[model samples]
Target: MTGIVNDAGNAATYAYDASGNISSVARGNAAVSILGFSPGSGAVGSNVTISGCGFSATPSQNTVQINGAAGTVISASSTQLVVQVPAAATNGPISVTSPSGSATSSASFAVTQSSAPLIGGFSPTIGTPGTAVSVSGSNFQTTVNENSLVFNTRTALLSAATATSLTTAVPTFSTSGRLAVTTPFGQTTSSQDFYVPPGAHVVSDVAVTGRMAIGSSQTVSLTTAGKIGLILFDGTAGQRVGLQTTSSSFGSCGTGSLQILGPGGSSLGSTALCNGNYLTAVTLPTTATYTILVAPIGTMTGSVTFTLYDVPADAAATIVPGGSAVTLTTTTPGQSEVLTFSGTSTQRVSLTLSEDSGLGSDCTYISIANPDGTFLVPSTLLCSRNYYSNVLTLPATGTYTIKLRPYGTNKGSGTFTLYNVARRRDGDDCPWWPRDHADHHGSRAGRVSDLQWICGPARKPHHESGQHSLVLLVDFEARRYGPLSLRGLWEQYIRRATDLASDWHIYHPPCALR
Candidate 1:
């Protein structure tokens, strides 16, 4: 078309076959521009990029060299190029070239193996019957099933295993131990236990026999040869009953139901079903104080009863504030005794002479009266019903004393018991009351620990708002005082509660939750 032709203005051209082999080539000088030099091709495993081919076609070359290295060509153009490097190639610079120009880029490739699984922990460490535990581990696949692993002889459903973790419920009929863990790659073996001890005494109380009505209320005590089990008051049966134990190790309430009966053995409708292996308190349902009978229910067993009479209160003597002599006397058989007083007077309390008709040692009594009348406490004479005597503080303001005839006739005497009550120190400024009255009373007097008895499980069925009365029937009977004193036993319970409270603040286990 143009008359003026320039040899230097012509374009070059090339060509190739479908197999990427050079087929034809040409060079242009001026007039006619050579349009086909042809694009380059590569092998299947070859790294490639396509660029710089000057052709009217949008995609002239299907593939070409990637900086003379093997890779995958993602895209190519006249000005730039892109490729996925072969796994065998380390990160390096890449370029593409054609008849017109070339293009280059920085890239890399990589291959890696799967990761390992992680473990959280095993469960049911105690190993109890019918206990369900979980084995927590990470790195599991979603397509797990029975064919996955032999879990306790059963096909375990290969559970959902994710890139992070996996879970499966423990199979039934599994052994009482830990199980094995299996994965696509390998297997692991481990085990755990499932039981814990119920920490408490597993025993009960015993039965009762004769009962009597004391002072204002009808009461009864149950006494056996050894330890007692259940001590209940059957208001329905009009009987003060209890269940005693032959064996000291276990008792009735440990495994049974106890009820308070009325006249004719009819259920007073009070029943306490022992929920724990050992119980702290189980009361009798009766406004009238009665004893309870502990009986075994099902396979459980225990025994206990209520016995022993207790005096409500009595006069305890100490020097009066007006300097009057503190007169002390024993209505029952007076034996072991101790008297204490505190005030301003510094005079010794004398024995104001005791009169009794029963026989036995009378004058061989030990009496301790503060010479300066500052302080006189219980005499270490150990006075039982076997001993009898009277002690008096003679106008002693600050001191106290107790007289005890350890070996003597105690029956029919006006005073057959001893009183060893404690009082405030005399003459030390601060003065308290009730000097000598507790010792000579029933069983053990004034000791809060003597109360190991419960009253009733008598359901105060939900009625009108607050119509139910709290009927507490107590039966305090001695079985064996053991080596522990009443005061000591009470202290132990207090200490236990304190320890539990402290632990609640620490680990704060599930049971401690509100």
Candidate 2:
């Protein structure tokens, strides 16, 4: 036995065996003490650090019980022991037993049930205000006040809630945004934005009368104009709205066409020529009632079956110059994909269409139109294979619309590139000047003559001596040079002028020639 003084200045005695191993120690009846613990409350399986004195150095020898359940000790020291709350632990005192003795905490450790809520999916993903949408997931509380659902910035009213699902009424102020749910544990938001359409209407089995007369036409009334309307011909897909007659007296059904007339009988779009079967997609330009005029090429009489579906108004995707190529799919026959882009006057805009393979006999059609809805360049001929436009030079600077669709009953997928080409600007001199002059002479001459007439005299002369001398001689023999001679001399002057223009890079000719 040895007498010693503890760090606290308390008298202590140590007893050891013959091997000098300390078997027991007495600290004047000083029992194990628990000062306090961090995070006074925690859920099951939560790690807690209890700070106190009189604990075994070996963690396995120290037994820590939380809420009447044995806690697993992670580490133990003379003054501290880290333990994990055991399963089925309740709210009760935390007691620790060291080799010396045992002691209980002054306060009980709180055990809480907590878990983050999860969302699987929702019903009626989209709806107008005052719509009730049901959400399904897990870890929802049975208590109503504990759950919160929000659509965008507005908090929705919770009608009911379960462990796996929740029902909420869409708030009136909700906009097109994410739907989020918050619980005591955590919060989660939807992966996609809920779309709230502005409005919608559907018309079924609309009877369209096909007329044989050239001027005669039929009309179909629509509730909303300026919106997209999908028309189904003959109650089937991939069919055109027109008369189908077998009589030889009737011309080819391919020649039939329908014109969309505005409320006041104003044409909204260029006539959609029918190819026997038709499913036309049109955007009404006016809110007033509209009509579809059937203009068959030959005498024909038939009742066409059609259904009109009104779709919400949506802006066409804009494709700028040098932008990524756009892939267009003709999901339905005669379905048009509209694209708008800004173009400068004389900008060489070209479109290259490449059809997908295995699409036998299917053709793609592209049409370039002005902002006024008039076709700047009507739909090109059916392109069964890849087709490249003739490098169209924009006539003016404004927004241009490009419509892509499948020709006739052909429907498939294709990709098109709309990009600006770096073309040689127009001038008096030809790009291929002095080489292959004959081949490009006529085009160059026409361009120069048009520019000269439109923009007045050329800024610079083509030939210092020859062209000027010829013009002077023509004037000198004005009377002798007949209309035919004068015309011939004028042609020569235009040819020479274009050559000079090409060299100076004055203005670029229209893309038609390219």
Candidate 3:
């Protein structure tokens, strides 16, 4: 095949092979054409495939340049060629040339860095100020000048680094945010956020209890603004722990508060500002180390006394019908002892508390509580007296708690006896109501009439029955006035009844007069 073209008044002839392929073209100059290229953009040292109409079949003679840098040709064909981007290449147009002519691409090829930094993960994801954390990744430079670690936009001081790992101290101002590492190539950010612990003062368990004193105060230094002082204690489940703070002598320093924080920094309980003293108690939720955070609410600058007490576990004992009496004593002010006993519904129990004669103060009491920490009967106060006793009928079918504590601020020792009482037959000692056949011809006074009939003589009773009957009468009177107020009307009635019963016992007086 042959074709003719007029080139500058000179006739140029183009010849083709019998297979319809270009054999040789007689033109003034060798022209080149660029159609397209695969992967139009790449980084340095990356292999790029360029496709266009070209004249060269030998790859070594063909030259490819990107961004003014010479590219190494890997292979060449009549319509396609592969070349490696030079290391010094920049973002610019690509050019290809042969011994015949040269062709420039219409589009530019982007030349970027070879490898970007990648983050795998970091150790000690949660930390506080000055905490050292190790970050592991790839493409990190060993030189400090070329590599940098940033936490929440704050630059961290690098201690050491390798190609895949870096060690740095957490910045003081760092917060909870993404961590990023930057190199000469590019920057890579962590997939998750690193956690920074809330600022707090680290304190030991012994330091909290041994240093702070009552009445006398001590200064608590804070490291940062609004900082909380943390005290850690190892605790067991089912243990009762008490925290009390004496009134602050800050004078004008400002107010502060205390909180019981759980294992995970959750608030369990707190105390209110009462004068300067605050008290709180909690039963441990789990057998683990717990954190107590003492934070200032306003301006905290004064001295305060902090106290912690671990209440002993309740020593439980069981009592049956006509069981032997058991005695307990209060060892400290506000100290409590718990006794557990099981009984069916409507079972009657008699509890007796007698102050030790050797002691001068009458500051002791006893209370009955249900299984779920609710009061079944209010507490009984036995102050300024030698002996006190009461009888209660159980209302629920479960274990009952007999709680004994000191009556007032002073800790006074006393002996307490508890036993199950058999319900009196024939209703002789029934202090609640009169018997069925007995005449109800008394004044209509509410509790007064009930007290008179219970304390009065039985219709056919004589001998030792009066003593036990009188004891029940006093117990009913004490119950009427509550256990805490055993001194006023109930004591007077007891004194009068004891005198009259003693006279009747010796003289064998008639039932109506007695």
Best by lDDT: 3
TM-score, ranked from best to worst: 3, 2, 1
Between candidates 2 and 3, the TM-score winner: 3
Residue 121 displacement in candidate 2 (angstroms): 46
Give the lowest summed-lDDT range of ten residues in model 1: 504-513
For candidate 2, give the lDDT of residue 20: 100
In candidate 2, stretches whose alpha carbon ends up further than 4 angstroms from where it belongs are 1-276, 282-315, 357-364, 371-376, 425-514
Residues 349-420 of candidate 3: C-alpha lDDT, one tens digit per residue: 766555554332534456788767788777866554344345577888898877766433344444445555
Q: For candidate 3, which ten residues in a row score worst on lDDT?
A: 501-510
Q: Over the stretch 1-514, how does candidate 2's per-residue lDDT look in tens digits?
A: 2444457735455556779997766555455666568788987766899876678989998989886799899988887899988877899899989887887775689998878888788887667677778998888877888898876556888889999999887676454455678886789887654433222311221222221221122233222222222221112222123222112222344544445444333444443333244434555442222334444433333333332333222224677865677765554444556678898888777665566662325555668997677777898754445554545778888999877665544555556667565554466432312211222233322221112111113332233322221111111111111111112234454455444323211223221121
How far off is residue 403 in model 3, in Å? 2.6
lDDT of 1 by residue, 1-514 (tens): 0011233444344455778775665544522222311123322333343323332223445333334555555555543355554545433344444454433322222222333344455553432223344556654444555114333333344445554344445444332222455555446544322111111212222333333332122222223432223232213222222221212222433444444433223443333433212111122333332323444444443333322222212234543322333433433322333444453343322222233444222322445566474434444333222222222334444444444432322322322222222233434221221233222222223221111111112222232323211111112232111111112232333343233221111111111111
**What value does the lDDT take at residue 484 in candidate 1?**
17
RMSD of 3: 18.2
